[model samples]
Target: MDDGVRNTREWSPPPPASPSLVVRSPRQTVSRLRTRRTHRDWDPSLGRPSFAARDHGPKPSEVYGFVGSITTVIATAVYLAWAYTPEPCLRSLGITYVPSKYWALAVPSFVIVAVALSMVIYIGLNFLATPPPTSFSTMFDENSRERMAFSPAMEEERPIEPILDIGVVQINNLMFGDT
Candidate 1:
């Protein structure tokens, strides 16, 4: 793979030569730029434009993202103004179409509380579903897949097997000096 990459890098095709147009004045510069031919625009082999050449504009997703960002900023400003502005001032300015600002705080607070409660419920469910430490499922569950074991004498010849689970006794002995 390395040799193939090195060979290709060393013998890659040279880029097409850029056209040189002598510009008489600043006025000609703009015209020359409009007519300028890049390697992408011209093909040296056929002396014409390449069939693959395309002037792709921004993708639909890119346009959507730009519009979405602008919309979000505008909406945020509107929400902040509606939520924070004094009721007396808004009435004085003849602005009565806006909904009550209570929703602005209530909606966000409700979302936060819902998310926190969901996490707590999920944790409780997991605890309820867990098997006890003394259960046989701890050593060999229905879902557990066993790896093939190799003899110690033939370990070097055989490929290394994935790690197998050890008992808590072994773990405690290794970490706590057999206490």
Candidate 2:
């Protein structure tokens, strides 16, 4: 805290370039990156800028998420202002050239309807792909197996059948005395 230096822009004799950054070959360093950085970054000690200075901007990946979140917040604020602001008040605020208020309501309404419709479509697709309880495939398909005799080698081959639909009469008898 008491270095007497003002800030991060510590204007001192630049530190020696690390072995990794020192890419000198045949007199001049490979200056493919010199064009990217401004002349302000030129170090008198090194004679020219290196690729390290060109990397001052934020990484592409980091910018996407940060910008997306900020954009969403700004868009939401603008949408709310557009929806609730009174026309005369807006006009007084110098916002004269605007679309109809009906669009503000209609856009959100359409978006909500679209989201609801997508959910319905998802459910409909699931229903379309599934066989109903009463479908013939539910009772028996070509893959259905008949009950086989118990193997004497092992009485507990299986305690009960693996996959078979129960009879409606058996279900009714269990639930109703009249059955």
The model with the greatest TM-score is: 1
lDDT of 2 at 179: 39
Q: What is the lDDT of residue 47 in candidate 1?
A: 56
1-179: candidate 1 lDDT, tens digit per residue: 45422222223444545566533688776886777644444434545443555566899999999999999999999889889998888889998777877898998899999999999999999988999888988677555545576678986688866666666676689999857
Report each candidate's C-alpha RMSD, comma-separated, in the order given.
12.1, 16.8
Which regions of candidate 1 deviate over 4 angstroms? 1-51, 143-179
Number of the top-ranking candidate, with lDDT as the measure: 1
Q: What is each predicted model's overall lDDT from 0 to 1?
A: 0.73, 0.73
Q: Mind giving the per-residue lDDT tens digits that candidate 2 earns over 1-179?
A: 43332122433444768756654585354464453443444445545455765557888889999999999999999888988899999999999987888999899899999999999999999999989988878666776665566777886565766776555565688889563
List TM-scores for all candidates, in order: 0.55, 0.44
Give per-residue lDDT, candidate 1, residue 46.
46
Residue 56, candidate 1: C-alpha displacement in angstroms: 1.4
